[model samples]
Target chain A: MTIENYVILRNKKLTEKTFELTIDAPELARLSEPGQFCNIKVSGELIPLLRRPFSISQVSGTEVTFMIAVTGTGTGILAKKQTGDELNVLGPLGKGFGIDDTFETAILIAGGIGVAPFPFLINKLKEQGKEIILFNGARNSAELIKLNFENELNSTDDGSAGLKGNVIDLLHANRKLFVNKNVKVFGCGPHPMLKALQDYCSTGNLNCEISVESNMACGFGICQGCPVHSASEDKYYLICKDGPVFNSRDIIL
Target chain B: MSELDFTVKIGNKLTLKNPVMLASGTVGYGNEISEFLDLSEIGAIVTKSISLKPRKGNPPQRVVETTGGMLNAIGLANVGVEKFISEKLPFLEKVNSTLICNIAASSVEEYTECVKILDKYKIIKGFEINVSCPNVKDGGLIFGNNLEAVAGITEKVRVVTEKPVIIKLSPNVSNIAEFAKVAKERGADAVSAINTLVGTAFDIYTRRPKIKNITGGLSGPAIKPVALAKVFEISRNVDIPIIGIGGISKWEDAIEFMIAGASAFQLGTINFVNPKAAKEILEGVKNYCLQNNIKEISGLTGSYEL
Candidate 1:
C-alpha cells in the first residue's frame, strides 16, 4: 500500500466523457497489482470530501494510469486536469485476481470503463505464456476503448459493432470458447454485466473471478461502507479488502 | 522542543497515551488498518459495535455520499461477541493502544451478557456502550433516545465490567445533555457525544430514497457544528469526561472540541479520506500546546470563554 501526491504526466480524452490519466508515481507504479485500485483525492475542497476509487488502469516504468469516465463531479475534475498538476492517490489497495498458470485459456470480459484494469492483467497473463481471449463491450462502438490485443472480441449495445447486445450476449454467442477446454473467466464491468457473467459461469461450472464496483469511501477496510454479501456465509465482505475481485461462487454480487 | 502532556484520564481508571482515537465502526479490530499506520500512535482503537448475536446488517445501497459528508446505514453488522473474541481479538491484543470494545444489543439482558463475555479479555481497557446506532432494528436509537433506557443499559453493563464505561449517545434526541447527565449518574466514566444524526437523501432522477434503509446516520464535516453544540451543552451540565466525536478532520477541530469540553477526540469519516488523519492531528495537537506555551494538551479542555 502506497500514498503519494503524483504529478499528472498525461491526461488524454478518449471519448467525450472518458479519459486516460497518467501520473508520475514510481512507488505506486512498482507496487500496484492487477485488479487493485487507487483512492484519489478529487479536489482540494471539502464539499466532495471523500476520495474516489479508481482501478490501476495501467502501470508503466514510473507512471500509474487510470481510465476514468467523467460521470460525476469527482471524475469531471480529474478528467479536466492539466499535465503537471498534483493529485493525491492512495493505492494499489485491495486484492487482485488470483493469476496462476493452472488454466489454459483466460477469457477476459470487460464492459465500458471496466476495461481499465485489463491492460495490466493482459501483460501479466501473457508473461506467464497463457492464451488469452479478450471480450470488450460498450454502449456503442464510439464508447469502446482501443486495445492492442490481436484476439479482441467486440460488442456494442446497439448493432454498431461485432455483437448487437452487451458483453453477456457476446459471451453467450461464443459458447464454444469455454467448452472442452481448461478455461477460467475474468470479468469487470457494470453490476448488471458482472451479474450476468456470474450467472453464466455458475451454470457452466466454469471458474470465474470478477472485479466488482461499489460506493467505496475508503479503499482500505476501515470505513465498512462498501459491502457485498458473501454467498457461502451470513456475513458481508468489504469490496476494498476482501476483494474488488472475488470468485464468482463466493459472493452474492 | 518543550515536553507536552497528551495523556487523558477517563473517569478515575484508564489513561490514554494521546487524545486521538479512531471512532467505532470506522476502523475494524485495529488489524485491518494497522498496515496503513502504527496502531500505538492512536490513543485508542474503538472496535465496531458487536451484538449478542450476529447481524447481517441493512441490505445493499447502505452508503451514499452527500454534500460534505456521507450517510451510512451499516446496522452494526458484526461477527457476534463469541466469534469476535475468537477471530478479531487476537490481533487487537497485540496493539499497544488502549482498546475499547464497543457493544450493542437489542435488550438490556443481552447488553450485560455481552459485557460479561468481554470482561475476561485483559487487553480490553474499556467498554463503549453503543446505544446510538440508527440503522439497527430494536436496540440502537430506541435505547439511546429515551433517558430511562439509557440509564438502565449503562447501569447493567457497569456492574459486569471493572473497565471504564463510556456511553455513546445519539444526537437525534431532544436534549443530548439530559442523557449525558444520566450516564454520569450511572457510573459511566465518560460520554461520546453525537453519534451520526439521523438523516436521509434521495435520488432525484429515480424519485426514490438514496439508501435502502430509507434513513441512515449522517457523518463527516457536515455534522461538526451540530456535534459541537451538543458537546458544549453536555460539558456545561455533566461532570464526567467527554470524548468528542463527529467531523473532527483536523487539529483545529480537535482543539475546538477540547475547548468546548471534550478531553479526547475521535476521527471517523476523515479516516476514509486520509488514513493518517489521527497521527497528523496528534502531531498538530502537540505543536499547538508547545506553541501556546501550554504544558499539557488537557489545558484546552473547557477553555472556551463566554
Candidate 2:
C-alpha cells in the first residue's frame, strides 16, 4: 500500500535476452531480503495498464537489483533503458527465500535462468561452509548459465560443456555424491525441471526448496493474483504474497 | 464561456462543473485515490461497478500489462446497491461533487433492482450502466455487442431513474456507431464510449499464461486509438453527447477524446501510477482551455474531423 518512486540507476545486460536492472529504491532495498520482488513501471506511456513484477535478485544498500528477461514489449523496453532514467518501481514485495545455518552440506540446483536465486542465496549460505553441491542445467551449451557455481560445487550444461543432459539428470546419473545425506536444495527454472527435481527429492529423500512463478499483480499480496497450490494446507496461496519461494513439499507444483 | 462560468453538459441534462471526470471501476467510490488526493476537484467521481447483489469479484490475477496498456478481469467487486446507498451514498453526499453510480447487472431483473436501490439516494445525480464489464464470463459481451441488448439495458435503467442515464459502450462490437444510435433511440441521456478492450499477456519463459484468468480487458494508452475511434464513430452518428475513455493518462489524450467528439473525459489505470494524477490533469485541462482560447469547454468537443 506504500507508494514510493525509484529511478533506474543502472541497467546492465547479463545476457542477450536478459538484463540486470538496478533501481534507486532505498526503502525497498533496506527492507528487501532474499525472496522478495518488486512491481515495476514498464513505461511512462499509459497504454500498458499494469506494472510488471520481478524478483529482487540482489539488494545492496539503496539499489534493488532485478534480473529481467526481455520477453515482451514491456520488458524489451526495460532492457533498452539506459542509465539515469527513472523507473517507477514498487518494492521488496512478496515473500522471499529464508536461510538457516543449521545444515552444513547444501546442494543448489538451477534450471536455465532459474539460476537467479542461488547466487545471492549461496553467498549467504557460504559463511556456513556447507559443502554446497550445484546442479545447473541449460538448453544447449549456447544458453549455459554464465555464473560460476558459487563455490565451484559442480557445473553441468545440457549440451555437454562441463557435463551432459540436465542438472537433475547429471545428479541421478552420479548418485554417489547424494547418498542418503540430508542436503538442502533450492531450485528455480522451467516447471518441468522443478517438477522432476521435486519428484527426485521425494524419492531420494533430499530436503529441497523451490521457487514458483504465477500471475503477479500487486507483488505485495494486495491483489492476490499469483496463486500457487499449498500442498500442506491444500489451499491456493498467492505466489506474490505468500511466496515466489516455497519448500519442495509445500506446493503441488 | 470562460473557466469561472463554464459548465459542460454531456447528453442532455448531465451538467458537470468541468469536462473531465474519473472513469468507472478504477477510482473505487473516489475514496481509493482521495486518501492521498481530494475527490472534489475532479468533474465527477465514477465509483466501481455496483451490481444489485454483492459480488465477490474475479479470482486473483485480475490484471496484467500488455504492450501499451494493461488488461483486467476484475468482476465487479462491490458492496452491493443497498449497502452502497446506505453506507457509501451518505459519504458521497458530503462531497461537493456529483455521484455517477456505475452499475452492472447480469439480468434485467438485477439491473432494475440496482436502479430501484440507487433511486432513493439524492446524491446520485447520474447513472453509468456498466453493461461493459469485461471480467465476467459472457457477462460484458452479452449486453454490450448487440445493439438491441445495449438499447434494452439502456431503456431498462432509463425508465427507473429520472436522472441522466449514461450507457457505457464496450469496444468489442464490430460497429460502435450502430450501438450508440440504438442507445440514443432507446432513451439514453448520453453515452460513454469504449470501455476496456479485450486482450491478454503471458510469460514466454514460463511457457504459461501471464494472468491466471487467461484473458482480460486491455486498458490504458494501448486502447486510446480504439477508444478515440469508438468516440469518433459514436459522436458522428448519435445525437447525444459522447464521453470518451480508454488509456487516457495525459492532457493530450484527453484533448484527443474531445476532438473525437467527446464532450467530457475520464481517467483509468493512470490512477495506479500516481494517486494525484487526476487533480493535476484537471488543472491541466483548465489551463489548456484557457491557453487555447476555448471560450466554452464543450466547444472543444468533436473538433477533429475526418
Best model per DockQ: 1
lDDT of 2 by residue, A162-242 (tens): 566677777777677767666677788778988998999999777877888765544554333455667876356667667
lDDT of 1 at A40: 94
Docking class for candidate 1: medium
- Candidate 1 lDDT over B1-306, as tens digits, reads 557787887678989988898999888777767877799878999999988888878877888899889999988888899899999888877767679999989999999999999988898999999999999888899999999999999898889988899999999998999999999898898999879989999988998998899999999999999999999999998787999998998899999999999989899989888888888898898888888898988788999999
Model 2 per-residue lDDT at A50: 66
Q: What is the C-alpha lDDT profile of model 1 across A1-253, one tens digit per residue?
A: 8777889989998987899999989899889889999999987787789999999988889988999998898898998898999999998889998888499889999999999999999988898988899999999978888685898889999968779989888988887876788998999999999899999998989899999998888878877778899999878888989999999999997
Q: Score the docking of each candidate (DockQ).
A: 0.73, 0.21
**In lDDT terms, how accurate is model 2?**
0.75
Error of 1 at A1 (Å): 1.1
lDDT of 1 at A96: 95
Tens-digit per-residue lDDT, B108-196, candidate 2: 77887888878777778888888887778755778887777887888887788898888898898889888888888989888898888
iRMS per model, in Å, is: 1.3, 4.5
